[model samples]
Target: MGRSRPGPIRWLWYAVGGRLPDEYREWVLYDLTAPTWVLRHLCRAMVQHSVWLLLLLLPIPLTLRIWMVVTGVSVGLFFSLAFIEDASERRLIRQGFPVGLNRKIREESSGAQRSELAAMYAAYYTTEPDV
Candidate 1:
């Protein structure tokens, strides 16, 4: 029950000054020390599929080299975005986003970890003045 990416406003929220996690899985996996929770089982599943896309490229027929290359690039981009998300999360934390450190502690956690980011944003908004 989670999304695949943080929205523009969420990014903006972090960009300005908020430290809460966009996803809860990120909190448990990267922020927590034990990180035993797998609240949204699909988080790791997506990661596995992303990697599998790369591995599958090697076994295709020779005539499909172009397809393989395209597939590889797509998978690589997905991996890159995943990394970018983590990096962004770290940046948001350093910038003092609410719960930033907790988000990072979710351990390889991505967008799938958050259970109710919208509520978090609502809470965050109350603490801020309208601009």
Candidate 2:
């Protein structure tokens, strides 16, 4: 969560777990390579923080308050992003997540059949200038 200020070590942990080896290099590649597990980890953190807020907030030491706040903020932000991502996925479904659909189709189709379909589409489209 952008609003949550994690300590350097925690930040590094997230970076590493997310498969972002370097902060400054190939940002897109890092994102593409990011593990879905990291998101799940964040979700777990969010839930853990909520439980802390409910069960430990009043009893924890002041020194621990910072952690509680950061975790709580991070949880809120993570859920927000999750919602946004879900919305985007739904939108992609409507407008077409072609790459995703293609992957599914490829996985389900025989290689020879897939190749034949590809060839047919290529041949048909190549002849149609409007296409």
Best by lDDT: 1
- Per candidate, the number of residue pairs that clash is 21, 0
Each model's TM-score, in the order given? 0.27, 0.23
Model 1 Cα lDDT, one tens digit per residue, 12-131: 444333454635324322322223333222233344344435545566675576667557666755674556445444544453455554443344344553334433433453364769
Task: Output the lDDT of residue 20, model 1.
Answer: 45
User: What are the runs in model 1 whose C-alpha is more than 4 Å off?
Assistant: 1-71, 74-78, 81-121
Candidate 2: misplaced stretches above 4 Å?
Answer: 1-29, 32-55, 59-78, 84-131
lDDT of 2 by residue, 88-111 (tens): 233224322323433333445564
Candidate 2: minimum summed lDDT over ten consecutive residues — where?
Answer: 24-33
